[model samples]
Target: MTSLLLVEDDAVIRTSVSLALERYGYHVTTADDGLSGLEAAQTGGHDLLLLDVMLPSLDGISLCRKIRETSQVPILMMSARGDGLDVVAGLEGGADDYVVKPVDLPVLVARIRSLLRRTTIAQPQPETGQVGATLAFGELSVDTGSLEVRRAGQRLELSPTELRLLLEFAAHPGIVLERATLLRTVWDYGWDGDSRVVDLCVQRLRKKVGAERIETVRGFGYRLNTT
Candidate 1:
């Protein structure tokens, strides 16, 4: 059975989701607050994470940021409503996807399965955890084999997920890649994959490699501007 980590503050909602997910053939481990969620998340055992954006103790955003630093664990954010800002924030915080409150169990299950598919595909070299054979665009250099990143002679240190994301973008330089496509390929995420994850990672990468390196296609996808 696929294992999952569910983090939510509301007791009733958490219980309901746990039950629903359990019925769908998932082993669910839940946390009531962001602090506990972060702790559980770092244990590094679960297959996917279902996080609520509005969390008590530490807040989901911060926890997400911290986790994104080292692990590429698929994260699915939950919000109270279909609030765009919250969705964006969750994505920016490193969540792979988001679902509005009053979640649809069936839909959520579908998303999880999709994420799992991507995850399994990415597991081709399951034990290696290495990628990005040779990425270069306009002086920016990334060595996936050695996990080395640099731009214009300046060395860059990025989180594991961020490095994979950059490699994915570099692999398709000049061609626009959808946000969801990036999520699934780079981060192993599925379901309602949020654009914010791409947005935030791009923003962070921009700050490092220069914003001009990444082009936003708006409503389509993102591309690396080698020129």
Candidate 2:
């Protein structure tokens, strides 16, 4: 059973979502406010967190940052608004994914499962037929066998999604990786996947990998300029 911590302020939403999640075979633990959620998160046994963006004492974004300071536990943020800023803020605050309110249980469950899968996957090993055993682009070095990345002699703290995106770029340096291809490869998204996720993740990756490493292809998608 997958242990989950749900931090939601709304009474109806908390109860309803908890029951729905439990029916889907998850072991759900609920917290009604940010303080308690933070405390529960610190206690640290849950496999994932479903955090509401609005709460008392501490908002979801702040709580997410605080938790990130100590844990890399995958987080899925929930908000009533679909505002671009809210989504980007949640992702920037260290959330792995976000879903707007009035969330359809099925879709929410699918997202949860995907995030869990990403977290649980073992670090990849380099295979003979793989893209590359090791790759170096400028000062950046990536060891595919160990799933390690080093730049300028310093290691970067990247989420699994971020690491995968970087690896995809390294595999095909200078190739314009279409958003649709990235969605399928990095996010495992089907035709219905949102391209915005790729854009947001690319923005985040640029912060770590340096903005010059990835080039926006204007009307197309993105290309990794190894030069």
Q: Ten residues in a row with the worst lDDT in model 2?
A: 119-128
What tens-digit string does per-residue lDDT give for candidate 1 at 96-121?
66678789886778767766665554
Model 2, range 1-227, lDDT digits (tens) per residue?
89999999999999999999999999999999999999999998999999998899899999999998888788999977566677778888888788888888987998898888777552665466756366888878888777778888789777777888888888889999999999887776655676778888899888887888899998789988886
In order, the Cα lDDT scores of the candidates are 0.79, 0.86
Once fitted onto the true fold, the runs of candidate 1 whose alpha carbons sit more than 4 angstroms away are 121-133, 141-168, 177-198, 217-221
| Candidate 1 displacement at residue 68 in angstroms | 2.9
In model 2, pairs of residues that clash are none
Runs of candidate 2 exceeding 4 Å displacement? 122-132
Model 2 residue 30 lDDT score: 94
**Clash pairs (backbone) in predicted model 1:** none
